[model samples]
Target: MSDRYELVLTCPKSLEGLLAEEAAGLGLAEVRAQVAAVQGLGDLETAYRLCLWSRLANRVLLVLGRFPVGNPEELYQGVQAVDWQEHLLPTGSLAVEFSGHGSGIDNTHFGALKVKDAIVDQLRRDSGQRPSVDKLSPDLRVHLRLDRGEAVLSLDLSGHSLHQRGYRLQQGAAPLKENLAAAILIRAGWPRIAAAGGALADPMCGVGTFLVEAGMMAADIAPNLRREQWGFSRWLGHVPALWTRLHGEAEARAAAGLSREPLWIRGYEADPRLIQPARNNLERAGLDAWVRIYQGELATFAPHPDKGQQGLVVCNPPYGERLGDPASLLYLYQHLGERLRSQCEGWEAAVFTGAPELGKRMGIRSHKQYALWNGALPCKLLLFKVVPEQFVTGRNEPAPSQARMIGGQLVERPPAVRTEPARLSEGGQMFANRLQKNLKQLGKWARREGIECYRLYDADMPEYALAVDLYRDWVHVQEYAPPRSIDPEKAQARLLDALAAIPQALDIDPSRVVIKRRERQAGKKQYERQDQQGRFMEVSEGGVKLLVNLTDYLDTGLFLDHRPLRLRIQKEAAGKRFLNLYCYTATATVHAAKGGARSTTSVDLSKTYLDWARRNLALNGFSEKHRLAQGDVMEWLEADRGEYELIFIDPPTFSNSKRMEGVFDVQRDHVRLLDLAMARLAKGGVLYFSNNFRKFQLDPALEQRYAVGEISAQSVDADFARNPKIHRAWRLQALQG
Candidate 1:
């Protein structure tokens, strides 16, 4: 009767039903919810209204046609059958978004190109002109989905997604999308709470997304009122008068609602830099007068006294996805629970987090939890009412299943508890006692020296053949493979004893301990991954940050034995060009760059290590003037033409990597490697050569051409004092004529 057409409203997967309900309320006929989308019959006015008002919908698509196809040619012909003149002028620009796979459309980019070609060809043959593609923003956006040899074509009527509400000009790290934030509020019953004259607060608000959305919902403001444009604005079938009428009515309702007594909407952020941005965003949303933002810490957060009680307190806290440590986030969550319990007695709180295990650390029971998705990550929205019983106080005893929290302090829980006194074997007791003595001695020194990462135990006991390294709160245990002469069962027993005693003696959580076996490596074996977790932890050495993958590679990326050498390099690298050969993870290069080195060149055979080197440099704020090269060190030494004032060369003891042109035995090839590296050195340059070959002997010929001095004693740090044979070093300089 009124030019009826099929329409599809797309939203996030979990919000399809909500979107369908909204569309039905908008008077769209025959509304039905489907997977990730809603379908209905709607004319021009209905489409325009839905485009302007549906907050949950990502896109309002007008179903153009559906066809079956089994090949790329059929797909092209199917798209070409559409009438191009009805959607856009020949000069109008457009973009196609292709998705799914099958029927010869193997790639999204190739499918999109085919669709564009079909459109351009049709327009050119019909009107002698073709529209160009605009990727950023186009007059028309075409969406093509291919599934099981069928193609569904539609026109996207909502451009740039409805989540871009045009209010936020600034954002904190890992900001939540506006639509997801709205869904959180809806799930938490914020709209009903606001209707009853209740207030809202987000103590950890990042750029005020939830607060603005809440303010709009409370004031009856349209979410898209401030948006600059919509896809339907340029569509040929758009009804301008209908859109104008709906927009005017929304404006009148918003004005009337704003005239009422303002609701109390507030946000607080600990970062002072974000306060101004949050305020600016509020002003852009025209909610500056209605909402308030304050710079305050979460520990001291409280609702305004003038506002009503019994509202919603919502926040999307850091989940350690992109930043922060998951282990350390436990304290933040515990503190949040404490504050909410002590300060917000009657308020309801909702915490949206990707890490549910950390949420348990809150020590507060949740009344309800809604499964949600934050983009592709599965997450949960935990809702709880602030009651006195939900707050556990003065319970110093650790929960049986939870980590120990004693005297308001985070302490490691024992791995297991027994009523009878636990007994250790003679060798196991000796290993345990040795770990305790080392902790007392090295722990004092490490704290005094401000070193967060250091070797604690390095095979001090003959039976306990393991190297235990402390990385901040975590410990990395590497078990040196026992000789075949030893009984396999006996060796495994000793290894298990050492692992058990580590946490007990060091007071570390067993979950924080990572165990690996070290043996003779060959042909990229050292670089090969034993696990595919891809988990990286940030640790500090010499006041510089580095990423270490404990679960992935055999090596931890940072060598604890080279601490003093790195320190020496940093001290002497100021304003000089530094070069690092066989720079595994480039720890020395990071130290040099941090010490104001003029520039640096790091060479390694593995791209994995080079990428790690780049991350270490970037983590230390050293991005420019640093070059990382991936090639065999032998080949690179021969080819490098640039001169360096300071060079550090540390070669593996023996490597037969496939990437290398030939096998490299450092003991046999030391002289040749040093000669080539020294040739690229400036006249006054200093070359520091190091290796872990216990029986390495310096070539006398090197002393005949240069001033060579062994600095092994001076280079060994206190942590590796007992293991002096761990490495050897020599400082060489060009002989003065």
Candidate 2:
């Protein structure tokens, strides 16, 4: 018999069983699933096919040798015993990836070094042209695993982590690897669904990993069809013709699948920033025509497939370290469950989350749970059949009961579709009462001004200490961090009472309400990481749509208190150059642009804010002649030569951002900040300076140097009149010469 080489297919932990099943299906013999790997006996051709087709594997290793290793010396000697000449040229390059820890080789770096030294030293010749080390695209890649006191050495036939499928170069902050996504799809029974011409959808499809992986499987396309490089490409034993034939067959199968009608696969993402990148990834995978992506919110995620066609609803929602509020994350999962029960009846739903507690709170009973790993974090894949009976539907619903079959008989029952209302505490009733009263008062004012977002209540009761804001129908509840004097448990209890009172008090779905505790964070930490989920909301302000990320940022993009100021800028922006300094999301610049400003430039130190500003501008068709500068406003002003006819400066109360050259206190730096801005003030130009510092005092020198008028009262709208200290504003103009 020809050499029956050992084949080891590695995968994410808990995926070895699936990998083994796949290997057996692909005609590998004696396949057995082991820890984090599946080993089998296969010929070189079977190994090549496995590299090209195994969707669950991270690497396909061809075992070249195995030997006992008592210490570091034996580890090196074990690798040196292999005939390196047969696999690599004397002048070629090699890389070693060492794993496991034993036999005094606990450090992976040192272990890899030993393996590399052994290979290179064994290949050493008199010509002094020995093999060099190449981490990427090496002539040959060696992998060694130290198990107990033994070592198993192999050659890596798959390069660059097969998870890098060459399609998703751009991804969200916490994107799943392609192989993991594929395994998830398989666990969700996507193959059976796709064969029956069923549809697939992911409500929170970050970079469209699920949608693309599902599409590739449904389209009969090899997961690595587009990958150009492989570890075996440079191997001496690689059969070029055999590989070419396999590749050509994959291409033919892909073309034949593409010639048929495309499957109905779709992905929805709440973040606008990820939409284009997701689409680009789909395009790169050659699945853009088969898969479609849309900008959608999880709260409003309604999966609509072709008529009578229902398949899998798969999503890997953000959880654990990825999100801040456990309560808010519960509502996210609840939304997924609610959408499934109300919309996608008769479908299968798979939710992959690191926090199984959050998954349990989805209010759906999962028939099965699979243990999986996303990196080092232990996660679970909760699989549910989205029938009416599976929905838990209430806080006090009974735990799901297994179907009872007695004496070869089956009991018939209707789907137990029930929903118990969320209970409210005695204190919650008073909180709800206050919310209703405030809503009655502000409802008309909000409607008359065409306001879709406005503050409804701001700690009306000392016990609540919550600010309730209405964004269209969705309610954003921000509970100010409780005082140290207050009991922590009591504060949390009150917050929970307020949350329970919100949806009912506002006449909206509970999923529409998201609660976050507003703790006093350090400088710029709140704005540091945009919620990875991209919870961006587009609300209308001043007759122009502005993107406000209520889920992520501490301050909504539109500062409702500054409505009058933005309106003032908009009123006077016609045919004039408008500048917005420290423009958080460039809301004022958008107003200026919408009001037909000749040009608008916004400056800020946060790249995140600038990106938000760009999206806000694009949302309102305000891209032309508008510039978003990412730098300290002071530095931007000092280097500026252009003059603006209208300027709006809204500085922070205190900023010690590392991005800035020095600390900025509104009280101390207002004069210098304005002087630089004032120098760029064209003759007859108006500059509006504003800050949230309650103790702000405009320098006496500024009044002497320019005409100053305090418009703080005018800038505060009726909604903000309750707290005029929300911000202070002043209009400054160059004195007529």
Candidate 3:
């Protein structure tokens, strides 16, 4: 048995109470929440167990010495006065971590360094030997915290941030930090689910952080069990027997948990980049045998499988706040919300979204919404109870707040009259008409200039709620706000008034034009309809036959944003093998094959898109000798390697389900995905990687090992006609002369 000691477990700001509950549940003594930490008392075994178990904590600090000091000198002298020999060996390694609030020690690092020097100087003067400083991995970890003019020093029991968990052998694009993930789960009321048996899922499971945290809670596994080292391991007072006993108890608890339904955990990602990492992490945590991993989109992902209804579904879908287009992301989120309501009716869901405007598109009202931080950006996690129609409420019941007296009466705007055909007021009908005519004129100009696709007007028609777009060989169906009234004559007059102004508003020639009404397609097919202007057309570019769509879907013509990437392919395709992945219409591959590549291979999971790609290749007059495969990219990449000299990887930012796979998110697995591309690249080959994920962080590990550069400027072309930042493009080369 070991002597009991009081301890304090600290967490990041705003997460104090969460840590307290976790500590108390671990059977620690006197566990109570304080300002920014949880205070408790326990034997040495309890301390060991807490270090290994607490998921929400930043680090655990053991109370070593406490002394009140008003100034920096006082802090240094007081720290130096403590018995250095009692706690640490003179020859061991030590590190200092410091944080301060409202203290004289405003520069935390300088204050921490002073304390370190004092301790070492004392040890050297008294014992003729001193400990070395180690930042990467130290033998003894010291912590200094200053709050309100007082310095509090403690011994760090957890060396690295507890969030590391040592289980992540690999990570995906924009993987959530582990501690933040735990905090989110707690905020989402995960502990309640752990108490009751139920399944948990991450529909857009980028690297599976939410699922893994939920699984750890369900299994009651110690968070630190997979960790390679802890600060306490090198503590002067560390007791081997006590640590061993705590480990045994934790193992016993895990054994007891095995009798229950293995905590239901699952993650689905259409992007295969996450599939292997999710598996690797689960296995590292010893939960691989328990959790299920799937590759598919969320839209087609069913709730009740052969067995039954899942208990919970959590999704952290893209908001397009920092990448691509925000409107597109809203559409994606709306689709996801529909999937939650229709496909997962009985299951509870927690959706984390960064953009509020996008959240409104979800249609279903969130029962409860909590604010959290995904890194520095503020995000909202909305909980949907997912009750059936009989139990449904018209609105989300608001949380109660202290009442206040009303200051003024509510006023409502008067409705417009319809009998007069809603006169062409200065800002309403007249304004819309001008915008529509201008769009038509712009369309004619684009056609004359041989522009395959171009914007007729950049939001010129605001009052009639219309957007004008021009595509070669066809005019696009404009996005319009439908008329509210049922009266036919009045609606027709308003429509004419809105359309009359298009030519002048955009300075276009009206003679070379056509207009199409935007009508809702029946059923879910509307979501997947590419664009209305996808009508088949063939044109010659640089003596190469090119096939283009004029009317069929929402985006049939081409992605103007990749003009630069297309040019790059044409430039590099001479006598090389070209690979296009997630190849939308095989446009880039067409350019490459036309550029005289020996071979071009296009891979996509959608046969619909594959057919479109083949059409694109034939339009470009590329030899039919080119290859096209419809399969999962992971399967395709693994089965074939070292085959291509130039590869294009521009994945969809987010999609729930496709015909072949589940959801795809680019932010979760760029590292390994890039590595796969590198492995497949012919010696000294190049990979052009681009993702619309604005929040994407290029893995530092990959950068250190390979030569990578941002080619966004080179990737943007005149067709995009928008900010070049719309997509981040990277050029990666294999290291060699």
Candidate 4:
């Protein structure tokens, strides 16, 4: 055996370019990108350095043997033929992982078992001792992949998935996977942005994944710098002295690249829930001192704090999934366009979304839109360059009061007031004051950190006293709610009227803001349905056609809380059976289906909601294998359980409807819901369950029942651009018994 050998490193699908860039930066030779891996010639030191530094990889696989195979037995024979003694210790523990297609050895587990037996047999016969099998954490990790009937076995130099970069101290709802975040950054040409001192912003930044990733990339900090262990560290051939020297060198390089505010990075949200997590993660990544995160609504996002000719504004907003109507989302996007055109000038902006049609509302021709994968779903990253003057002038709409243009300057005239504090009660005043402060601080934070569109308040704020909560187009305050002397019935009308006056007070076109009101639900009169009551057409500030409608089953017409999860659904729903449970209006299901899923089926007990689901699907032109049914999902699954490749389950936190079901509380019955979902899931399928119930707990029994991963990172979108933890979302996969 040669003392040194050539090795090729593989990354997750679509991350080959990033891996190659990392390899070449490390001075590795022959760096090239393949389907899902990068190939290069490297010695042991080079392998160690790559494993220790590469940010956009899942694992570092060291090629051991390569040959063609047609059957499982040939796979076994090929593994047995390798000189095991050269790389494997007779007594070390090992694990075999397999991934492939188009071969008789198609069953990865079965193929892995065969290869494992062959390795153990070879060791036992040659040295009279067999290596132990440790599936979870092995002393020596092995990867076996087959591409076009050619099998290549390699030693996994990265012990754990490289995504566990070890810098995150805590996670919020819907945090982005580190490797995936890096992949997005690389795909977005983030390095170029950093090199040119461009800003990096994720309007909806869950747990600060984008912020932290951009910071690391900007500072040229190695992703794995904080990781303490690697698969190669346990390899028999690992040289301690060499590894120490490599780590030291890497540390020195990382230290040199550390920045004292090198690139601008910022994040925002309306909800306060995600702010702490974002701050915590940034701090742990050693980027908090340089990155700033704030809480506010996107409508109020202003970039005037810093005087730059142009910058980059990136947003990953919700795609009407797990929220409300697609129409409302369209309105949000339309409002966002208004904000962008008015605030961001001389700036280049990219909108990462699973929903393509929503791009129409932006009103600007995309410079370039790249097809990329968030996971399995097809997503488009639409890029646009904004002219400064367009952003400023396009923001002004017709003022309810007449304005005078004198000396080429527009002058505003105020109307006589009714006085008496405008009947804006103490409680209403408090909520408005808090909201104003939130927006103010958020603006500062965005300017400081280089992020955009953070959340100021999710629908869950107690002060609003709103049942369904709200997502705003722009953060504005008005004289909502009547005085104490007014009757209760009159007060509600006054409140709505006051709400209507908000746009004028904030200098926004009345047509730009859409409002959903709260009213008594049919049969359940104790509860109110704050549904959309009317329609208003808003001409784009940029000469684009826009529509805004309200008067439906939901008050806000949108749920900004689940923005991150909708993006995740769009990213991972392709070629999969997506079952959306408690699917409300099925906006998220529509997004999943639009992401190119094999089929989509939504389940909810309300006929009204089911009909709404159908309408949403129709709105998106989702006429394929999409179905909406009115039935108790729990009973439907228990009776005729269906398997789904991907599932999105968001149930009401507390509900007691007379529509034949008992009281439904997500916190009380999540286990049963999960169990039902698991029974209906196909092998390797994922289930995404979310609830607005602030304090929720996963049943402990689930630890042994499924392979569960919290995917709050994948949930974030641009609109619900604030605290990630406003809603709890999880990813669950079935585990064979």
Assess every candidate by TM-score. Answer: 0.60, 0.62, 0.58, 0.56
Per-residue lDDT of model 3, residues 1-737, tens digit only: 23767688877665777788778887778888886678888877777777888898877887766777787788888888778787788998899888874436778778878889988999999889999999888888888877776667888888888888887778876677787788888777777876776778787887777877787778877777767688878777888888888788878777677556776677888888779988888887778877888998865665554356367888788654221133335346645665665566677788877765455446566788777767677888787777645122232232334443456745443222111111233553457555466546655655565555655443344435444455543334354545575464444344344443333344444332343345443322333654443447665443345555534454444665676687778888999999999887788888888788999999987777788888777665665669999887766787885478899998766655545345445676677678887888888789999976668878778888788998887776443444456588889988775
Tell me how candidate 2 scores on lDDT: 0.85
Rank the models by lDDT, top first: 2, 1, 3, 4
Q: Report the C-alpha lDDT of model 2 over 467-583, residue by residue, as the tens digit.
A: 888999888777788889999877866776677677778888776676666765556775776465677877888888888776666666777888898888899999999999998
Candidate number of the best TM-score: 2
Superposition TM-score, candidate 1 onto the true structure: 0.60
- Off-target runs (Cα >4 Å) in candidate 2 are 125-129, 298-301, 320-328, 361-363, 394-501, 508-514, 518-737
Residue range 247-348, candidate 4, lDDT tens digits:
888778767777444566778777788789779888788777778899978766765434353566777777544213343465466556666665665677
> Model 1, stretches more than 4 Å misplaced?
72-86, 89-93, 107-138, 321-324, 392-737
- Whole-model Cα lDDT of every candidate shown, in order: 0.84, 0.85, 0.69, 0.67
Best by lDDT: 2
Model 4: how far residue 690 lies from native, Å? 40
C-alpha-based local distance difference test score of model 1: 0.84
Which candidate do you rate higher for lDDT, 1 or 3?
1
Model 4 poorest 10 in a row by lDDT: 539-548
